[model samples]
Target: MTCSIFFSTELPNDRPQVSGALPRAPQRWTMEWCVKTPDGRTHINNSRTIQRATVAEVNAIMATTINGIKAEIGDLATFISGRLTSHGGTRKNRKGGKRR
Candidate 1:
């Protein structure tokens, strides 16, 4: 099975007003997932809305995600390099001479 994930921000269209009352907390971010099966069917799922998230909270989440992606890239580079080294440290021409 293969899955795709998405993240989005939502804002209220309008806020209700009342006499001498504070407004409701804002609804901020949401995480959604779309899953697909070989049978050509898709399923969508959503996480509960995140309300009133602070700047630091959002920053931390971004930093963590970036770090995770960087780690994955490094691992992939290592794997590819290892594969190349195992096959032969360098490529050769069809005439069996090193291509420089």
Candidate 2:
């Protein structure tokens, strides 16, 4: 049983979608902090220095994300319903590359 066999989910092959959150608060460093070396590799710290989060706490935080998105538009239900086929994730910092 290899990784490719164990954790493979398929999506429809199509053009990628682009999206942006209009009125969103800046994402900042919370309990989950990571360090990215200059070489472009990302490291998630899992040490005593970090406080552990409970499942409930994490879910609560994630719920706020939807609230933030709704607040960004005049009518979230309408906006989302209209762009059901489009709206993707945040596009900021999309220049995913090693800046040497």
Candidate 3:
């Protein structure tokens, strides 16, 4: 599994547009992501864009994403540790018995 973070200033056609529509405020920022797997599976977040987002606003987004990733990693590590410990410890010999 791989992950990445990216930033872009351009908004896609789906974004609201009108003859007199004012440009997005400086604080407004757009964010999105798409993923395709080898098996022709795809995933995307269509409504993740931020409105009237400022530098601080964007920073907050980044911080929250980073924190979430960190928490998931920590949880996975703990799960792995628990699984290993429960299965006759990490080092085992044949017949599912602990090794000397």
The best candidate by TM-score is: 3
lDDT of 2 by residue, 33-75 (tens): 2333445554442211133343334335534543444464322
Q: What pairs collide in candidate 2? A: none
What would the per-residue lDDT of candidate 1 be over residues 1-100, giving only the tens digit for each residue? 1112222222134221122222232224333334344455544444433444433453355445434544744533211100000011233446766565
Ranking 1 against 2 by lDDT, winner: 1
For each candidate, give its TM-score against the true structure.
0.28, 0.26, 0.31
> What tens digits encode model 3's per-residue C-alpha lDDT throughout 1-100?
1112233223354232222222333333344444333455544443343445443455566556534544744533211100000001132356857556
Which ranges in model 3 have alpha carbons more than 4 Å from their true place?
Answer: 1-25, 32-47, 75-100
- Which candidate number maximizes lDDT? 3
Error of 3 at 73 (Å): 2.0
| Native RMSD of candidate 1 (Å) | 24.6
